[model samples]
Target: MTLELRCGDVVTGCEGVVSGNTEEEVLTAAAAHAAEAHDLTTIDPATERALVAAIHPV
Candidate 1:
């Protein structure tokens, strides 16, 4: 039960992807990558929801 999320699908002008065995793991890694690579310090509630919604089984 792998899960994946693509930043390009949710964010414009970005091409990042994260995957994990669980949604929480993927989201955690994605957030860290976003902070370091995309300069995002925090993900707003709506954006978090959107990210979750964008997650797909892979």
Candidate 2:
């Protein structure tokens, strides 16, 4: 399964591949991606929480 990631109103997971066998790992990977590739230093806390919550279960 693929996890759809939305930044604000922009969807970023459509053309991308998500890694991890579980939701938690997937979101963790995504956070690493955001920090590494996107340089998102000010990413919203709520958004991060939601991402972790939504994607952390497989």
Candidate 3:
């Protein structure tokens, strides 16, 4: 199963969606997206928790 995460779930107004074979992959992609598109250079504990919670099997 693939793991997917909707960027909108964590960042309001973002419609990006990222998926991967593993949670780590998706998180890495999401981090890149965050940095490139959202200007988020760091994932704090709360944001990291939210990102993990938002990820689901697709």
Candidate 4:
């Protein structure tokens, strides 16, 4: 099964949806997307937890 995450679920107003074969892959892509599109350079532990929690099987 593929893992999926909607950027909007974590970041307000974002319409991006990222999916991957594993959580690591989704996290990596989400990190890149956060930096490139949201100007978010770093993710704190709390936010990281949130990101992980937001991921779901699709």
Best by TM-score: 3
The lDDT of each candidate is 0.90, 0.56, 0.95, 0.93
- Candidate 3: 10-residue stretch with minimal lDDT: 36-45
Better of 1 and 4 by lDDT: 4
What value does the lDDT take at residue 16 in candidate 1? 88
lDDT of residue 40 for candidate 4: 88
lDDT score, candidate 4: 0.93
For TM-score, candidate 3 versus 4, the one ahead is 3
User: What TM-score do all the candidates reach, one by one?
Assistant: 0.91, 0.47, 0.95, 0.93
Better of 2 and 4 by lDDT: 4
Q: Rank the models by lDDT, top first.
A: 3, 4, 1, 2
Task: Give the winner by lDDT.
Answer: 3
Q: How would you encode candidate 1's per-residue C-alpha lDDT over 1-58 as one tens digit per residue?
A: 9899998877887888999999999999889978988899899999999999999998
Where does candidate 1 clash, by residue pair?
Answer: none
Q: Arrange candidates by TM-score, descending.
A: 3, 4, 1, 2
Tell me the alpha-carbon RMSD of every candidate: 0.8, 4.5, 0.6, 0.7
lDDT of 1 at 23: 90
Model 2 collision count: 3
Judge candidate 3 at residue 12 and give its lDDT. Answer: 93
